[model samples]
Target chain A: MLSIPARRTNDVTPSEITPREVFERRRDFLGTAAGFALGTALAPLSAALASEKPLASIKSPLSTPEKPTPLKDVTSYNNFYEFGTDKADPALHAHTLKTRPWTVSIEGLVKQPKTFAIDDIFRLGALEERIYRLRCVEGWSMVIPWLGLPLATLLKSVEPLGSAKYVEFISAADPKTMPGVNRSVIDWPYLEGLRLDEAMHPLTLLALGLYGEVLPKQNGAPLRLVVPWKYGFKSGKSIVKIRLVEKQPQTAWMKANPREYGFYSNVNPEVDHPRWSQASERRIGEFLKRKTLPFNGYADQVAPLYAGMDLKINF
Target chain B: MAWWFALSQGKRHVGLFKIALFAVCLIPLLRLVWGAWNDTLGANPIEFITRSLGSWALNFLLITLCVTPLRKLTGWNWLLQLRRMLGLYVFFYASLHLSTYLWLDKFFDWQEIVKDIFKRPFITIGMSAFAMLLPLALTSTKGMVRRLGGLHWQRLHRLIYVIAICAVVHYWWLVKLDVSLPAIYSVLLCILLGFRLLWPGQGRRNVISGNFKPAQE
Candidate 1:
């Protein structure tokens, strides 16, 4: 065409001639087609792949690049007693939980008590990614990247009364669905609670997802509490009810064995558990036990919250 | 009656049974080694190995306890021949369990281990039980039995009953909430100890000697 500029040997390639818009449009088409193909290919396993989503972008100074616990370990090694007593039992049994259409009732000592769908809870605030160290009462630890809003944001929306000293979390208890609930390993409708101030702390998270995906069933799908400074058990999973109360709530483990599990359940290295020493903890991916940190190494941020309180007595 | 006499003679097939039992006793350890080699000890290998060894030790203790009652009830007095071997396996497993705690779990941190032994009730009881088991395991040889004399050996071996109790208590105290397994062991122990109370002469007569004879036969 028009002598083709004398067919110069140094001319631009065909890709260079292509318009940027056209290339972008082609990429978009290909992406959609691949997604559709993948969707069809993974149809049978949709339930297993139900919660796979793009990672959230919200950042914090606390977030670490130290590779989070493998998704396999995070999902499999859990202590959700509603499923069973064994650590492996929750992963084995919790998949039966239906997370969609989940609702959490925020009642008691609130000016406006409401039962909000999980989606609505998400809409309440922008979800942020927070990587935190979860130390279990059994002297095991895991680094979890949780995606959620701060608990204070949610509590503030509900408008708590002056009398609300404690916030009690009630987990779901459908025995027909949760096989472990049929057994009396723990009291039904597993209950956990925190002091109102602790509940409202910026570190306290109402977690909706983990590892850049929506929460897996075993890791407490749809909704759970993530208290970075406390023992993992204190962070109740699959929470259905949040009741702001005047009196201290009788937590499940404490009710089960008061001497062994206390109400506060803070991560204190000096305070040995009744049956075993808590001076050291085994991080899940590591071999040698590492010395346990006071307040799980959140002593700088959260220690001031418990300024005068004796951790051993409160623990 | 001739077949029964032949079976209880404690000579024929004794070596074969002893070899088989020896292999069987090593199965747990072999399986644990294989598991460690293959990286199949799950998320917490130390906990898994410790628990497996501890349970095996308790099982052996119960098995050793069962020997007297079984020998008396079945009149297969030759079962006495296996008691020393079974008791020795108990010591083997218990020693391995303790070593896992001391060497592996504590990493030779003697100060912390000692603190744990003193502060933790379960560890304290467990260490006490291991201490009680030491002399019995050492005296398991035929030479030791001959040197100590049968009466003294029997008196020393009576410590097994207390060791059994201590082992069960150690297990019972270690569990967080599910005591079902320990409860089952306790009931079995009760039946074994109760049977001795009901029928007293079984333990006294069944104590084996180096030059053995079937007491009932």
Candidate 2:
């Protein structure tokens, strides 16, 4: 049984997991004991901190040639507002988050609504190594080699209704676990959305891990969306509720400041942020700022989806 | 003669205290240098260095501004001797902050730097504050005070008030969300600057006119 008390009594707990938690803890103890017997005190302690087991994945054709940002740098310099606004806050505070016994409820305008266990989500398809160029609205970029399958795999399982136009992702914002939720920094539960077609794009990833390992707690452990064609925030983190809707879903950033953020936050250097220029972005490891590419260098694959739409107005 | 000269006369430990103060002021820079050498300045080292220098400048500015009040409350008239050094340190840190921006952040891309200065209000305000601090720093010496005259030098240094306001606003505007840290700075600055408004004759004669007489609490 999960000792980390559930937020809601009605939350579905699969019977098999009751023993799994205890087994996991016992295995962890055994692993630590074995590690100590080997006379490597640091091996277990370091592993205990967050070993984030290496996930099973194959080389992906979609992966970019650019060098991936250093794992420590990638994990530490995150902008997940759920934990806090500062880049380093998530790395420090996210350890309190409980990733196991998690379920993502898929409902609304779907023919076969389903509640997916974390295991079920992983079992969808063979995972791939997607090295993506992630451009943030704040003018910083990172090339991340992520481990995951297409988000469309999960979406196809639920089979959306004809009326569905957009897919909304809602992040878990437990005030008890996430201290940042106590503050009135934007609406509590972080929300992000994508056009139904955009959500189904081949480049759009249902990211499970990074650096060939299960994601660090700070990098939205358990699950997160990675929309390479859009601004980094367009990819929601620790997504709990996924909904297919008739109208374009209102995003957290959009609600916070509609004028600055919009429904379509595609990467276009020409359409600058109201406060700052988007022409150039400082790559994480490198000193020189690189010119931001259209659709973050995925324009060939994604631009066709928005051929006629004016990005300037939609942005 | 200034009231400080009479009261501060023959202060036995002031020299040693100044040497200690100078060393204490270098600690922030020392820590940054050590961090750089050790590769522990977080992921974004340049940003960390730039922000650290800016924060130190703001802290030194506030400390410099607080000297008068500290002297009044504690009757440590010798504290006045350290105020000039403290004010100069604000410029030292501010100069490093600007240099980091130009060198590490921008790579001396003057065109882009100019664009940032004009396009970003926060940058504009920050640059203006640094620009104002330059004249005060240059005229800090006794010779410059004599050449410019006491009244003129005092007027020139009064720009610290404006410079401090700009520094706070520059910080407050740049943060994307959670202004609580900057809000704390703003409140402390308000209390420090508020003394002038709340004091007798609005602290003009004793402060603005260089009236160094000890204020009766």
Candidate 3:
């Protein structure tokens, strides 16, 4: 059974799942007392700390009587291509990407510019579990249990100056390291940006891990953004730099094809991608009949932020 | 003396040729399994394994179909000797691809599996192509050939044409954007089929088939 966030009861919610949820759920699936025992033994060190941290609270507009899509479906299929790029090739390719010794550089419109190693950044805020529905521009949706600190917490540390209107995320780009980047498909150093207000949203997360584990390379290990309200690509992976700007920042997909991938890529069915329709999305776990949700069911949590604006024009 | 020697030598090479062909067909399957174990099967191993096997199946099928045309155009009848192995390789990879989907993707839930096969247009075509290839594989042996008889064997093998078309459609529909790769495969298929249509037994039949023996004087 689902409890819909009261603001808008009409939107859809992705099935909620996290890696920690998966470890608990695997007991029945693994079908062995010994397996459960082993999981229990492993849970304290691996699962306890992971489950203890609560992420930003997300409100969904839709409610249903059905159980959310199980954790198994959520973690198995993912689209984080920075680990490796291939619609179907990431799971295998991600294993090879190295996530250690990561450093994130902060530049643009900040009162104090700083570069910090991943470990140093993790020390800034306690982890929280934010379960949000992730909608991909490619018409597939998932409810992810992301384990990370809020974007606001990190932003406050940097102290964006009044002039900072937008914040841009730049992913690491070494063609030799990322084969997909070698090809001029969507531009190397995949870029994404958010308005300062959106960047400061509590729901905006700099996720370091998912499913109760260090982020698998396939799922953007080391670090990635998890902007639940916008399309998943806006949550750029393998992030190396955060740039503040006065005007709207030019994102990669927008620069590559301005008409198709807008910077404000909200999950709107009304605005069809010139190449495909956004009217429907395949829920990652639903076999035959997954339906689409407007704003991925976050209208209650963040929609008011855009209350007076024309969604289509802004979109 | 030459005619007698040619007859004896032709009979001698038949068994060895068949062995060579069988070896060629087994290599790809062995390589795939080996790659899987080694973690060299790419980032999304399951998808990589599935798609690779599917592509190889299609490739082998295309090569098998190309046999008659190549034999007719180049007068290299030995090419026909490899067709059985190539056709079998198609079955080998097609079976692996389907099994991976069943075991890995669907997890062998028969009801849902059947539902997906029926519901998804791409899966429908891909499954149909695989289903059509099964009988051809079942009748691959010399014993089965003898059992089916010459005319029946030829008739059953014609299903490859239908399978080829379905395979191309399966690929074309799956691609999201930049249809170039699928388009390239479709063009190659058209050319292969074109060869069959353009030269339907118009060229030499190769009754001698490289076992040339002058008429005994």
lDDT digits (tens) for residues B1-217 of candidate 1:
9867756675567777788889999999988887776656666667778899999999999898888888778776678788888999999999999988887689899998888889888888899999999999898887887788777777888898898898999999999887888999999999989988889655455554433332221
Point out the higher-scoring one by DockQ: 2 or 3.
Answer: 2
Which one wins on lDDT? 2
Q: List the residue pairs that clash in candidate 2.
A: none
True contacts kept of 2: 0.48
lDDT of 2 at A266: 95
Candidate 2 TM-score, C-alpha based: 0.86
Which pairs of residues have clashing backbones in candidate 1?
A: none
Q: Candidate 3 residues A85-155, lDDT tens each?
A: 45645665666666667799998999888898886666555454555677888776766666676788778
RMSD list, candidates in order: 12.1, 11.6, 11.9
Runs in model 3 lying further than 4 Å from the true structure? A1-76, A308-310, B1-65, B73-174, B177-217
C-alpha lDDT of all candidate models, in order: 0.81, 0.82, 0.69
What is candidate 1's lDDT per residue for A1-315, written digit by digit as tens? 000011112333342133566444755644554455433523422332344555332444555445466566788888888888888899899989998789999999999999998867766654667889999998888888888878998899999999999999999999888888988878888999999999998899999888766888999887899998899999999999999999999999998899989999999989988888888998876767999999898888889889899888899
Residue A8 local lDDT, model 2: 23
Q: How well does candidate 3 score on lDDT at residue B168?
A: 88
Error of 3 at A16 (Å): 10
Model 2 C-alpha lDDT per residue in residues A97-132, reported as the tens digit of each score: 999878999999999999998867776665667889
